[model samples]
Target: MEFGVSTFITDEGIGAADLGRALEERDFDALFIAEHTHIPASRETPYPGGGELPRIYYRTLDPFVALTAVAAVTERLVVATGIALVIERDPITTAKEVASLDLISGGRMVFGVGAGWNREEMRNHGTDPATRGALMDERIRAMREIWTAETAEFHGEYVDFDPIYAWPKPVQQPHPPIYVGGESERAIARVAEYGGGWLPRGNVENLGDLVAKVRDRAGWRVPVTVYAARRDPAVIESYAAAGVDRTLFFLPTQPRDETLRTLDEFTELAKRHT
Candidate 1:
């Protein structure tokens, strides 16, 4: 039961370099940053949390650049995108970024990706909101091809490319773990089909039910990571009993002191469970 923390990497938050050092000092398992390439002005997609989006979404730093800064400062603290918006990014370039970050971090990169829920945001990237699931699927498949093949090619509805060589293959064999994020049935299937794990959003009821359904339906023992707003011990125990491999706590802000305290608390939680 490894513990991780996710926060917005904004201009005003703790710098990624400092955050990395802090996590390493506290011996936390990983540091994940959430992503939103560029939120559109149109308010077509309601906030998943049922409130106005945070200003941090617009002020956030690029995830790869921020994680790279983190890698430069830490030795063992894993870095990741809590939910990288692959729908808005190019899969080929994204694969190289993941590989480069993994190499720089000594293979401690977890790629958590999702087909985001913002309709206007996807439209801004020229992606159809209705078909994002299919698009994301092809992107994941294409990325795997790029990561594992000496000369790779993929032909799908959303992604099609001729043979091309990709350099600096990921240090981790067969590439770093791709954790599919979201709770829909299609999302679980996507994880089983291409990802190394499933990253279910927080606020899930019946953790055991969902974990069992995913395992029974997908026929994969992929890890299920819960991203939660609260880290109550009882809740953690319930999730652990349900076979969740890791539970990442969502931090409200990235202040160094507050984050340090949470890391210590969560580390204690991890010690008890793991």
Candidate 2:
């Protein structure tokens, strides 16, 4: 399995261009960044990972903007959104952004999407939390139409548009690879319906079984990418053996030197498995 790095690119951390260059120089396969438009102060949604949410969540730079910077500085490293909240974004603008980035990066873009956990954040974007799954499905379908059709149009409960022109099409033919993120059965169903790949959060105890389940449900082999994977070589090796296509080690938003050191450590650990 190939290895990559995923992090929340915050205002106070290592810059995107620098991180991208560093990852490419180290022979890493990709660079994935997380996204959060803005954190609601009401604190209604509990952190998925538990306890207080990290400061980086509130200070993250726009994923497309940050990945564009990464694309500008590196050639081989895949630039991706670890999980762009589809429910929170307008499909037309997002489609343009994805296509433009894919063009700018010479087709090195992987669009990772999720329904999202923060209800308040989705509500703020005029998205109803109860129907986010259906909303996400329609939005993704709409974006796909926008990316591929000569005269794109979509009419759905959540997303609708008339036949219009969107340019630069995308360097990756029809569009960039869409990796749906989540661990639930419903999430897997969505991946089967539309995604090119699956992005499951954290280390899964029964990863091999999960991969088998995805294949059985999707009726085809679906590539699996595990995010926030442990930096242990044994753990990575186990995942590789379990049929994970890529494993992205999570990096904390830290100063350049410290971040680079951590990258070096992870790289060394990954080398053992490769």
Q: Global lDDT for candidate 1?
A: 0.84
Q: Which candidate number would show the highest TM-score if scored against the true structure?
A: 2
Candidate no. 2 TM-score:
0.98
Compared with the true structure, what per-residue lDDT tens digits does model 1 show for residues 1-274?
A: 7777888888877778988887788667788889988888888778877899878888789999999999999999889898899999899999999999999999999999998888998898999989888888889889999999999999999999999999889999899999888778788777778878888866788778988988877687878888763667788888888998877877666567776776677677777767
Task: Report the backbone clash tally of model 1.
Answer: 0
In model 1, the Cα lDDT at residue 28 comes to: 74
Off by over 4 Å in 2: none
lDDT of 2 by residue, 1-274 (tens): 8899889999899998999999999999988899999999999999988999989999999999999999999988899999999899999999999999999999999999999999999999999999999999999999999999999999888787899998879999779989989889998898889888999876667888888898889998898889999877778878888889998999989999999999999889888877
TM-score of each: 0.94, 0.98
* Clash pairs (backbone) in predicted model 2: none
Report the poorest 10 consecutive residues by lDDT, candidate 1. Answer: 251-260
> What lDDT does each candidate get?
0.84, 0.91
